[model samples]
Target chain A: MRNVKGPEIKSVEDLIGPLARVRPGRPGGEVSGTGARTLLASVTAEEPTGRTAGDVPVPAAVRRYGLRRLTLGAAAVVLAAGFVVGPSLLEDGSGGAASYANSAVAIEREGGDYVARIKDPFAEREEFGEAFAALGLKVGLNLSPASPGAVGEIFRVGTSGGGVGRGFVAGTEPSGCSPSEPGCVMVLRVPADFTGEAWIELGRQARPGEAYRNHGSAVGRYGELRGTDVDGRPVEEVLAEVRRRGLQVEFQRIIVGDGGSLSFEAVTAGEVGPAWTVWDAEAAMAGKVRLMVTPEKLDDNPMYEPGLGPGGLDDLGESDEPGKSGEPGRSGGG
Target chain B: MSDDRPARFEAVYREAYGRITAYAARRCDSPQDAADVVAETFAVAWRRVDELPKGQEAVLWLYGVARNVLANHRRGETLRRARSAGLDAEMADLYAAPADRGVEMSVIAEVFRNLSEDDRELLSLVAWEGLEREEIATMMGLSRNAVRIRLHRARRRFSRALAAAGVPFGMERRMVPAGRSL
Candidate 1:
């Protein structure tokens, strides 16, 4: 077949014009609230038992029947447990998830997984340490004094070990708070078998004019950072300037994909100097900056899928700390 | 009094329902499957509302969730829930033929279908969703550079595929602005 001259695609948008043309479906305004309500009830189980319009008790038998009807054949035991626990948590509506006002920590069991909701952003770090110590399940959220610009921001989050992971917090906002809203309440899902901590660094709301350090952005290859500091400077220049200032720089090679480019991250262990601040301002001008520097790297951003994390396991109890296996405080960078 | 979890979730539901439904309807083979995808996607969203992105980002964030849900359904990782009845009924209405939208682009579709899933998705995000590289990066949890490079490669591969499929040069070049090439 003679190769025909193709379209001179100017942008990514133009490249797949035909595919877009052929793509099926447009927005249809027919979504019912049933699915949302059901899932909400299952997650929170906050309604009165079997009485509220939203909360329906999901019996083990019903789940078993659902499993059998689908004939998944495998994972029947797991799915049955999920149907039972997930809906049951909400069946009573107000029970199951434990709340501690002292540490502002609330622990609830949903779908066999333990979800720790940090009700108080002002709770001391050791308080969390205490809560995890008492529960025998470790969960981490690092609240630090934030820069005036980043007050109440969730700068970075890290998770480690198997089964234990952190929730996805959208954009620059914290896990629970909306973008415009102040205050951050973190919700972390601990796997039933997870014996380690999922550490998160949140920017405590700063008083006006207070100076604070900001965490670096996790920039992927070709990721651009906008602001006066980095608006037009080449990547090489930014790195060179950082090194010139006698600061340590690290690079994480791209192990995934074609490995065409390297992962770019920079950080200072202490407060960000005036030099870094320039770059941050410039980068923010463009968009969320991409230099994933932190005072310390406590956790790898977990790959949190939709639905709660580890909602099917049930064996987690007050086990002793598993030898600091996933401590975020020790991982240093700023 | 302000709404509680269900009410807050309902607001998000109303805002994102149409887009998510369209996403599922386009990807799933049947209304039932679409229903499952929609139901499961919203269920997941409702469960994680506190963590959901605010504003328009919520919709894009949801695309990521729905993508995962669809993958699970395709892999048979999810149980068929009776909760999808409402979705099934709603999608049934949308199962109607999308009027002659792709007739002229049929050949393009054929060539596009020959590409890999990643490439197809990258291209679709640009063309179908009209997301810029930055938005695509955020949506996919990738760096903007990765998106840019990957998107560039995807377009090149698509152009090659189109040429191999014997599409006319003028028609092909028509889509690309002047001075642009594969």
Candidate 2:
């Protein structure tokens, strides 16, 4: 087997820095001392109640085994009834249960709206669809891999038939909960009586080798090149920094076509001269960077207008607008 | 054995608290969440102190617990078991500090974050936690070969994804020769 050690990329500690540098108290001393004492007290208090490690809920086994059907007896009945009565029963107010939960998802009817909390984001799409279908919803949930900032965000929605009035809204449970953070769940709220056939696509963690359908800029806050200014710099200077970081570099020659149309073409190292002007640099992948260059300096940076910075593009070829019905869109870094 | 549980827990807490706090801080978005994970992880450690491994291995055990706690927290299953105002304050201050953000850094972070959860965790165990392959295999309950294979696959996937995003070249597979054009 090949050695697992690869390039010397920045570690998470190097990227985020130490806790003491960011805070006042020592992490293990005063701060954790108080926390440890408090937690010990809480645990001691709970010990009288006979709560043990077994009492603490372990992560659901659903992740290990794929999606399991709704097993709650009452919830199962409600879902079974839904399959029999169909969607019309929900509007009649005769549906016995107003909520149902499985290992995969939990959906509740909140007045005129149906609130669904996605429990297993990696679960099969059919499982999500089944949960919605149980509530008599004609909604289809398609989860696609997205960049870090775009995960758990709804990127596209497409409706075909009737009854979509204003369509549905998709968001996180606690308003702006970061998907990577705790206590955050992806939420989809649809009007209870929506009769239209709708397809909703939400961003989920990408599988290995899967391409991210939704893209965020590699620059700016939380981006790879946060403070580096490569725009309008000499290729020689930028290449030196790239080499210094022990990172591989790739070059994209920016060609300005007629009518201000822009296109990028890959050029070999021999083709790109040291004096070529680099208009922009983007993180192409781990251990590698891509520099957008031109043989001569242009009047303005074609990648962005003045003062907009990284994600601010001045119409570089294709449209960058997001949430265009069926198309995957690019989102700015959060 | 039961009488010495408190002393053992204290020793482990004092030894591993800083690193555990850093671990949670790097992965969590908020200080409160990180605090909760740290507190809960130790609480579990206290409860199951018998299962806590000896000496340095204890920290690895706590990391495994913290990982599970974080997973539960992400699913919204972990109820707030231990909440300390002081710890929360400390975490808030830590988060308030400025990160080394840049366009390239953001892209790298995005690519890193975009990786599969398993891949991210495997890489983080090495990079963030600074664990060796044998240690990772022990913590993850896998054989050394399993760790080696998984880590290799994760690195390759990360490189491929970065290239697909237009960030060319895999560090392991595509090292550019010196004096060659970019």
Candidate 3:
């Protein structure tokens, strides 16, 4: 008789399968160590008075939650498909139960706002997305691995691109979620009267000295001006526009060498603002770049597009390629 | 129920300890973290012993609990810093620092890291946890259909990524089974 088999093993599965099998083993010894005994003792001593895992009754909130979830799923699909669903089509009325609980998060009506108890901060991003979606608000919390100092800590909170509302900020940490606690739960309060899309970034601390990548850049800090038109325009015209906007302007004359190579030198023209602009007529022909124009001088260089890095223009001195602009403000002498 | 809690917890603990340790060890950066994950998971089980299911179900449920605990730990929420000296020492026993995966494995790991967190989690649940679709649905609080759809998409994305990275791997049937069509 021929053996009947299930579906064929997939390639993706084949690749990752070994990661599961070969795990780092714990050092072997008696399992009943003091840590074990202490934990057992603590459990024994503490009052066992809470609902069991997955035992909470499905509350009426699930009904209201259902429609919101349906809408959210539709919105996500539409967005993922690259079809822009208007905000009006996604509008949801707010009137969820005062208290809602999930494995990932818990919500309780507090004062005029809703207090979200983040039960598992390290829960997958979709889980957080679902929890917030159920509450009939476009809010999200993104927790990711971070350096030890920033771990489990709220590093920074601000509105991200095209989010729902303004004035959203991190409130106090929930009493239950201390830094030392396993499964720290954080409490976030959104305005009771406010509803719309919002997001917050949370940090998960990596093991001490573990290499953690910081993808955040200090780009677009004050503002930015870029594009071929913006760069092609005369330096004086750009500065005039900056002055029109009631902002300070600092221009660097990008000088072109006689060999047709580009370089940057500070604009020392007291009247037009930099001297190189007057001396090097060919400089303006190369590119009329507005290197820096902020309300105030920045501590670090402003963030710029990565493509700009090839020309040696990103605020961070990451590129070492020749013909690229040197550090912000300091010019590569022509 | 009270009288049975300790024995029940102990029995399940012995049976599943290594698996849970492996689960956490594979994901965690250090043995201490894995130990803490194990300790917290069992501690939770003991406190809620009455709710645990019978036989293999309890093991599955424990896996669910450990999953959440690990998530919280990864988010850097340290609960119970003062775990008994003994527990700390025991946890340290579980700590084996990760050795470098030489070139090929490292390349695979890099490409895998490049995938979305959701994709990685879906693939890992299948590859690392060995969870079937339905089991993954239960653990992740998604419907079985959702799990299947996501798994398929995740697989497709991984395949594309691998191909883009110039990795040689097998191709599985791309179409969903008849009844499971999305």
Candidate 4:
């Protein structure tokens, strides 16, 4: 293939010559009649509920937190039993009203910012919004299901309107505090005078059939494949382990292209034979794992084949240790 | 500390509008589909403004988002949400414009279209968008070596297909190293 050089081929650009001629002119400027402005407005006006109608009722809290709306009787009963307490107001050092706390969240003034610590990640979304509303801010908080490594991490921060100074910052209280430890809490810091409408989405433990909005390696300590290295293992062995864990499995056939380049194609279970080797595993959803397999064993695990530091599982290092925090505002989801 | 998201997004939209529109126009089958992809891409950028990277990287990030949006559009998952008359008109004009379609170019276009979606995208990102390997890695969420390997394979497949079609390798020699086969 190397020595057979013909005169008809120049470059990929030449091959795409006239077909690349489609050039739509720029959309009108920021405020112009082009759909750009309208689209901007529509997206900016969107709330954090993942609904376009802007009127969907806030979803109920997940069952794991074991929390419910505190009715007058329920609140008094819980208080008497010493199982829970009502919201509390905390004053700053200067004796000013600077902080507020509820059963689900606590908002306090720290330096020039107000920090809201989530006490119950599974609390109803409305409870979070109400806390911010009480403090005269328009911030909305939604905690979505995520893999173990992403728990308590903020997935996205979106804001609109004006008067939002420095916007907001979301992180754990003790910096790298993991949700698995006591005294660890996910916190969001907002400017004291922030008056704009903002939407914040954080990660929480996923429920059955709830897809993870973000993920880490399945082989990490907290991952589903933890303590079980599936890499280079035969398909039957991995499938047995997956069934033992009561988890579903999917397969992606690894195709070695010319020059040893690799690509993957999703294949049905029947298409795979027990002799196929597993190259890597990914957290496909709450209770599912996707295995990358090949018909025969290769020279090296393609996941780490390119010598690019653990393939695409950069999260493995950060997510392996307990109580280790990930980078703030890590990019994931759409 | 000031809220400058709106301003920042506006600047990026202005700078990237044409390039992104052309990207959508190239992949989409119709003017409306192309317009919808453009609109949805920007809308997503606006919502995730804080995550949008700076300067040149921002365009690459937008391209990444546009790529996903295009995929969703192809799967019929994305609704025709952000349509406007102005965008529709612009896309229609772009698709309607005539091109210098020589017979050779036509044959090449057919062959290119016959390639898998992944191959077509990898090739176009190199030829049309003129993106480097690193930029493509960032845009596609792959390692640099992965992009290199995939690009090598895509090029080989394209050249072989061209050869099979009787299109001889022509005037300008590609910068393949002397002893390298592909």
Candidate 5:
């Protein structure tokens, strides 16, 4: 047997005897901590309640989750086959869960080829405008609505003829009512090949002693987004107050650079912590893209897709019986 | 007797569920992900309930099912790293100061992520699951002696990996820390 040595091992699935009794009315379902953790606030480590360790797989389990999972497996096979695509059409930030039915879309098929004119169940909705306004931070759009916690889709952004697609974005944090310290803020991320960059600009009130000079060109900036006091006001009022404070945002022009290099980055600037959480999968960011737009210039304009209205994310596969009560229930007490 | 079986199954589920959960938490990186392995493992047993051996033997065999399920879990761990649209903007910095009440969790998770899936699972089997080499052998289909040797190696490896990952190393695997209650 090719053995596992002291240094070659990583983790193990241990089995301790059961704890406590659930007899009669006893609340035998207590789930004390088991030491598993997730860095992203939304990525929870649930318990495997109502299930055991000595189990096997059968047809029913597969049939229930087959369609959704099959899609993912199919995607994996495509990427593994080295089929890469451009980021130009990656993010569809039209608006919440809106659908353009029976429309022909694009796909990266096996052997790294583009399968054009393929019909998608739905085209991603672009709601970055509403999301930007709702969060009250100045950022750029390069997003679309898709379920990551459920069945994740793919998104690739970069000038490299071949782009990397991480699939989806899910998980959100509680929204903030004000732009105070430690609150969530809205931010936009863009690839160097951004055309919207030149059109982008920033606007925020700069404090007297709170210098913005030390910060190099806005691309590599790291500031606390110091806010002005909007005493005891509603969230919308605070949004308006912040906008009137002039422009403090850094501007950038998205330009596809040399060597056919592919770079990725995330823009975290919002009052809501999860607002900054692009997806629960990756952390930090890498690149040299400049920030653009002030809070005022930041469009509080249309949030719906270029055509659709609100209620986009509503009723999407919600009735799909997510993690059913009986199909091998997992402990939600993560 | 027909009525007796469902009651018995419920009893078994109640007694063994948390144990399996604890076992999975130690080995798998995230509870939800670990729970997937655990749930799948137990669902197999439940479907093939009649095939399970009697008494303590059954417990040991359950460990075998968990082993296989975890193997499946490890294979898919790579998917968790794929790039996403909002990952940079949304995901909290893994190295930043953990602001909330999950420091122990973050530290443990960080340590867990750094370890290879194999070491983490075998050690968690012993420490978190409290399985003996003999029982583990039955579940994994290995010889008893081989189980002992493998378990020992797994434990040793876990210690070194934990140390390198900055987890409290001097402490034993069985020593449950103050934060991870139950």
Candidate 6:
């Protein structure tokens, strides 16, 4: 916690301590030309047929699934948090919930007769206050940005004003972007001494669960990099840590496609980032992990799992032609 | 150092790509933008690895590069909300709303709205981006502790914004309610 101003890797190591373990899965695989071709063909479903993968491709179904294959289609959804709405968007992974990367938490709790909509974007501070005003509940804004090296120092700094919400909100003047820019989420707080129920609403558009924002694009679906050195820290333990900190996530349904593939996220730390953040990864990519952004949306969308295929609904006209999951670059088996 | 640049570049790139990209994503306006930042930083290091002193010192050099990249990036955009100078004004009414990163960033804007463009740069370099206080000081041409104190007060102002807006108090329960915008 002392301000030693250590090396970048050292600092990053201190921030994450160690990456929690990656959930069990093969993060990377051979992307052969055939595979690429298949992926290209697979995403060619132009309309929705609502027939499931085995049936013919309905125009409507192909149309429905076509969006998944478009370049940037993935991050478009994550960024939708800047815009869209849905219950699936409210899943907050705090209290060591690390696997559900970038997921926010929103819960409507029964507070007396009124419903308290509590949400923790884990990014903004004022929403805590707004969440309070909306639901008439006291709020606790946990400001934990993932950092390295100075974990103790960072913790001290975070705990500086007593505890999380106990202290006043820290203000940041926009250094580069304007208040109108994206990172402008605000913070609101009630005195820790105040008495009332508290609830948080957390959610982001489910548009991009197929690919969480890993390194720019949603292609970050692959995970489980054991035994890698990050910012001077050993990350073999990150996998376990991910399990340890991952919040219990319950998918509406877990499915395996005709080919036996399913993307499951393993997390660590409830979404509020870690206790601290590390501006590393260059020295040793701390806090950052690789993931395979597949063509899977959360429960918000109506369709079969990636295993199910793009033509499941029969609403979109899809045919037995193997490449029609609306998924970009995938193999189809009827 | 130049001779060893490639080795260091590979080592650093192999290990740091994801996290650095994530950092860039968090800081930059877009993923493509973030990628450009990460990619460009490494590109620079590849060219000047020899100049980067060994060990932890190399890391600082990397930071310098990233800082430059970010500064350059912002400068190019030309949409700084506030303009000009002057900010001895006790940054009162700083309201931080938990917007999405689970922390309300808008509040940072509300509270720091009164600060001159320079002050936001000075404070954000430390508070939001997680840069060292001294590093921020160096970047902004300010004294070390002076930056620290300003940052501390900035946080306080943000906290006050929460109180004045009364957004975080009881509003949490009804987020995106039946009436409000989703």
lDDT of each: 0.44, 0.57, 0.47, 0.61, 0.31, 0.31
TM-score winner among the candidates? 1
Q: What is the TM-score of chain A alone in each candidate?
A: 0.36, 0.52, 0.33, 0.47, 0.17, 0.19
User: What tens digits encode model 3's per-residue C-alpha lDDT throughout A225-296?
Assistant: 211112223345545444444534334444433433434545443634321121111111111223433223
Could you give candidate 1's per-residue lDDT for residues A1-334 as a string of tens digits?
A: 0011122323434445534322323464355556544544564444322223332111111110000011111221121121222111232243333323234566555565555666665678876655544444455656654433333334445555434232323122253343236554445444444443456565554333332334323222112321113222233545544444343343321111132211223443243332331211111212223332222322221111111121111211100011111222222222
**Local accuracy of candidate 2 as per-residue lDDT tens digits, B48-101:** 666666656677777777888888787673334244556766766765444645
- Compared with the true structure, what per-residue lDDT tens digits does model 4 show for residues B67-159? 878887776633443445567667767765456555665667778888888988987776666665546765765544356456655776887
lDDT score, candidate 3:
0.47
Better of 2 and 5 by lDDT: 2
| lDDT (Cα, tens digit) per residue for candidate 5, span A69-139 | 11121212212111122232232242211111122222222122222221222322233322322222122
RMSD, one per candidate, in order: 14.7, 16.9, 22.3, 16.8, 25.4, 29.8
DockQ of all predictions against the true structure, Cα-based? 0.16, 0.06, 0.07, 0.14, 0.04, 0.01
lDDT for each residue of candidate 1 in B67-134, tens digit (9 for 90 to 100): 77777676563344465767867876886744653543666667777889788877766666555555
Better of 3 and 4 by lDDT: 4
Better of 4 and 5 by TM-score: 4
Alpha-carbon deviation at A69 in model 1, angstroms: 29
Off by over 4 Å in 1: A1-9, A22-99, A103-115, A119-124, A138-140, A144-180, A191-334, B1-111, B130-156, B159-182
Query: Taking the tens digit of each residue's C-alpha lDDT, what string does model 6 give over B93-113?
Result: 242222342334344245455
CAPRI quality of model 1:
incorrect
- In the range A50-97, model 2's lDDT, one tens digit per residue, is 226443442221110000111112211122234433232243355534
Score residue B127 of candidate 4 by CA lDDT: 66
